[model samples]
Target: MRTFIFLCLLFEEFHVRFLVLTTMSTISLATEYRDVRASEILKQIENGEDVNLTDCRIIGELNLSEIEVETVPNPKYSELLESGFFDGEDLKRYGVNKDLKVVESNIKIRNSIFENDLDFSNALFNKSLFFVEGNFTSTVNFLCTTFGDFASFIGATFGDSSYFLNTTFKSISLYGIDFEEMWVRWDSLENSLVFDGLTYVKLVRNFRNLEQFEEADAAYYQYRKLRQAEKSWILFQKEWPWISFPKCGDIFMWLTCGYGVKPFRAFGFGGLIVLSFSFFYRGWPAISLRSEEKIDRICRLLPERLQRFIPTIDWPNPGISRLEPNKHTQKVSFWDAFYFSMVTFATIGYGDWYPKDKFRKWVMIEGFLGWLTLGLFLVTLTNVTIRP
Candidate 1:
């Protein structure tokens, strides 16, 4: 009995020890996610100190715009300045802009949460600025911000609107930004982004280098669209149809080939046009076989589903050709409709099939579209494949 009692006490002791250890571990984890005021961090940055925060919740606004820093010469104009082509004063006189402030401290905040708005407009960072896996819960702004050195925001998430209007970066990574809240729009930064040709080009190059083809396409598409609009407005502002000519062409390019960047879109659109017209031909009974010889050829290559719908047609429609059940319309198989649609869309009239009187208009339209789509496909293919 005494031995059993001693065993029970020993078990209780182990249980108590386990509970204590677990409690301590929980406390440690909770501490890691401690709340830090955004003001404190701003103070750290203002004092030119390196910030290394992880797994903390930042409270209040961290407006970096208020920090007073001296304006640094823009390195982009450095070569011109060295060549004596344009001094800083002369550049300013010619309306060339310079940076407002420069932050020369290292910031390596990882896996932290910002609960309020953050602004870094018109500020340049000379050191590495990393916010890996950070979460911004409120509005974030980076208007005209420049990262002169390396910067990375990989795996970061933003809950509210985020802007990068006219922002510049060198050796930066923005590959894995999350916008599950539907707040981050890359095209225009919520309509705040101004059109800058060089900025858009850099963004396209950066996205492509990061292997984000879709993002790169979006950037290029937006750039082209904005540029087209600017030119149209400049050339024929307030003109009704004339002003819309450029936009019409732009829209056509977008629908057919995604502005010559996506070859697959042209291929897919071509296929879709063929498939849709094929259904139209079948449903309307628009096409008719020219002779018994062509019927025999088409039946052997008939699709199985089309074969099932067509009666008295053997599994392969072997040695079968029929005249129109009605004198006005021909009862052609689905294969004939598909074949005619393919030939019409390709503008390849083999003279074996002809559209009836009512179908001639649609046939002409399809032929023209086929010509256009094929040409666009080839052009887009060449554009994407044969890059300079």
Candidate 2:
């Protein structure tokens, strides 16, 4: 009996020790978890010291107004808000500065009221910056700010006009800035979105112009196109409830050219067709159809060098050596003429191409148009190709 009692005592003592160790470990883990909160870091900042939030995931809503975070020095925070740190009211008022540097932060300010006048003038970001689904109830200025990495502002709702004048983005993802549903005006300046300081390593992708202003202008144009498409579709739907062909055409054109539509080859082919038709036909005459006067008018529009290429029926020699008139002048429709014109301008001399005696002047006109069109296309292509 004494032996059995001794064994029971030993087991009880071991169980108690295990319970004490487990309790201590739980307490330690809780303490460590609390240490990672933004509240704790804000306290350090409030004490006028620099806090490195590097590789730290903050939890809960961060309210800068409540926490005394001032005079933060060289904070090495990276990949912040990766574990879902919610934003509080007027969040930008707390951390904004004239020369602040934020790198690789996935900050989401979903449904939060941002009333603070966030000023990031001359700020620099060396990594990905995101502002997804946030509501900015006040002005946010990024004047002269430099984004040295990928930047995104998708699904964000701005209360007022956001100023990005003179801001330079190294690489931007702006797929959602269309003004179809959103009513927002962009703040414009004389020299906004300049990309003069960009290096070859930090060039933008897809966009040709490295300048920030040019990119902004492109974005604005895209927005305008989307809005116009939306308006046209709405009018079409209202006017013709039974038929939707026109609306479908508008959508097809918009998808092909306006924004992020697919099958780029189709768009290119359509453009080529339009160009060809315009070239083949002399275009619709405003009034009477005096062929000679029309021909003279068209020739006058041709460039000086091309005017010399005009085939003269008065002489037997094919007036110009390299250039020729359209052979199917009688059979070609407006669209066909347009496509032919594009082909000629592109200098893609297909074998079946020739100019009839009646349309001899048009050959010179087409050649001139082709030269000018090709020159413009080359310039744009060069700008896009040169990354730096």
Candidate 3:
């Protein structure tokens, strides 16, 4: 009976060992099947097949190498994100790698929901990168990525800072991306970039166009205010000459009004003739016959030496002639004076008039002053009219 009990115990032990071996084999086979399934899924993704991970309940962290993900028929990016199957940790391990290739992917997230943060920093894209008409309910990071071709984010919305610092793109477009009050950084190392009508503050302030970099709002306000202030300062300088020359206000008024600077300058040099005649002839004829000859008689009474010194003095018929003997007796109108002064200063002789000796030389100096004043006026006018 004891021998029979020992054999039964030995048989029971053997059966227990056999059951353990079978269970282990079954577990091993199941594990191999899971691995094979995972590999098949990866192959399908690489072959540009549509993948729907929406119904997947348990998604473990996946680590992959040298894999490719292609969007076959332009699946919604947000739908994939909301499928509750893509864990951030899994993406960090399997999706974010320089060796991994993503080609011709049309990633759209049209008003879909998301429950986690998406980070694609330092990822290399070798083909067309599209995020057209998508909505990101969380922060999206695309820092330091090298886009080998066209990168588009047209009509995408971001809930936080859309950081793209040190990112390189051959061509980019962010036609409509609302970032409420976030800052966008798109610093690049190349040129030939364009940004048409991008309403971002940081973009407007830093870059000249939108084809290369993304946009932001805070930078826009800063640039706008700076440009406005510059315009205001230019206007003030044009309108208020006193601001430039406080004590010279009366001098400028005399040049403009009393000397007939405006009208003379506008006449295109017919005014110069009038001024020459006024300086030489002095005044017009009077009604009285004896009074008409009075200036002549007075001029003749002067010494011959004085007459020689002052050639403008016409001793023979000083009353009728433009040249009179006495300087005080010569009365020149403002318009005539300004014209003569401009011609003498510019040294452009009309030949219809002449200046008498040293007196003419003195008048030439006054002409120089007139030319300078007119030039300044024109410069100020241009500044006011055509601002930078």
Candidate 4:
């Protein structure tokens, strides 16, 4: 099934309903600025000059929308979009907004601050572009932006949300970019930013193209989680327990195995299951032992002082099991109970010990759980390891 990627939303920092919102620009503006106007920078770029500046405050909105139209056709293949940038799957929902502004200038504006919203929506840079350590006091939009050469945003901080909605790409680096919240929107009907389900699908495919399978899985996991939430709501609206099977199944898949991204969760849950059954066996006399138990016999082979700590019925004799039929049975150690629980869970009935009375019912349940968890573990292992 083709997931609707438009749901990835503009909440690249914001929109859920009509607009994706950024959380970084919540605080009251307090910084003072005395620097070049953003209009001048646009003029410089338009004049085909490389403008490099450091520690400068950019005043006025750096809106790249009204620039000379030089749009590149939306990338039709995954490989073409991997090296620089592309119209990501997020953009596919809105019927391809391809009126991209071409910025061929080599610009490096590092350690600077933007006093207004930085709207570089659909801007394509043909040269090296660096915005390292820059601070955006307001929303920073990078919707459908494409970098043809080196593009880096290392140590950048967004006071509000810096959006990458429908972000096209070739190659880019974003190390240590700080932001408070990321918001996504699913307003495909009227809003221009149509962040739907294919956004994540495209992203996951991109990661796989680069041979970053782990990242692809992680991205898929996030997308599926978000999709599950949406599905749960839709299911709730349509019907109750009768239609809740899908929702319940989704939750189970996520919790038991992280939708298969986290394989170790199965083993961890299995360990918990074993311990829980062990607690039941330890508190009550569930398992029975014969006169001279094999464990105690093995304990005798150890040093005298160590044998006391080995969960043996007696230090010297296996005859202790023969002495008492009632009171002696209750003196079960945690290890013995644990061993019995493990034996039952693993379906390895050695017959050295066996569950007694109603406790056999619990043994059956534990055995079932063992099968389920172990099966999940194997499935998850293959999911994380095999697929690209």
The model with the greatest lDDT is 1
Q: What lDDT does candidate 2 reach at residue 376? A: 47
Task: Point to the candidate with the largest TM-score.
Answer: 4
Query: Which residue pairs clash in candidate 1?
Result: none
Ranking by lDDT: 1, 4, 3, 2
Give the alpha-carbon lDDT of every model. Answer: 0.71, 0.44, 0.45, 0.66
Candidate 3: segments with Cα more than 4 A from true spot: 1-115, 180-186, 189-198, 202-388
Candidate achieving higher TM-score, 3 or 4: 4
For model 4, residues 157-233, the per-residue Cα lDDT tens digits are 77886666456545555556665433322221112222346655654665576566766777778777877887742
Against the hidden reference, what TM-scores do the models get? 0.44, 0.32, 0.31, 0.45
Per-residue lDDT for 23 in model 1?
96
Candidate 3 displacement at residue 99 in angstroms:
6.0
Tens digit of per-residue lDDT, candidate 2, span 105-199: 33333323344454444455554555544445566666555667666655455665555644666655443332112211233212222222121
Backbone clash count for every predicted candidate, in the order shown:
0, 20, 15, 41
What order do candidates take by TM-score, descending? 4, 1, 2, 3
Give the residue spans of candidate 4 off by over 4 A: 1-194, 231-243, 290-292, 297-328
Q: Write the per-residue lDDT of candidate 3 for residues 143-257, one digit (tens) a residue.
A: 5455677776666667655566546667777666565433334335224133334534435534433322223222443333333334422225555633434224434433443
Better of 1 and 4 by lDDT: 1
- Model 4 poorest ten-residue lDDT run: 185-194
Better of 1 and 2 by lDDT: 1
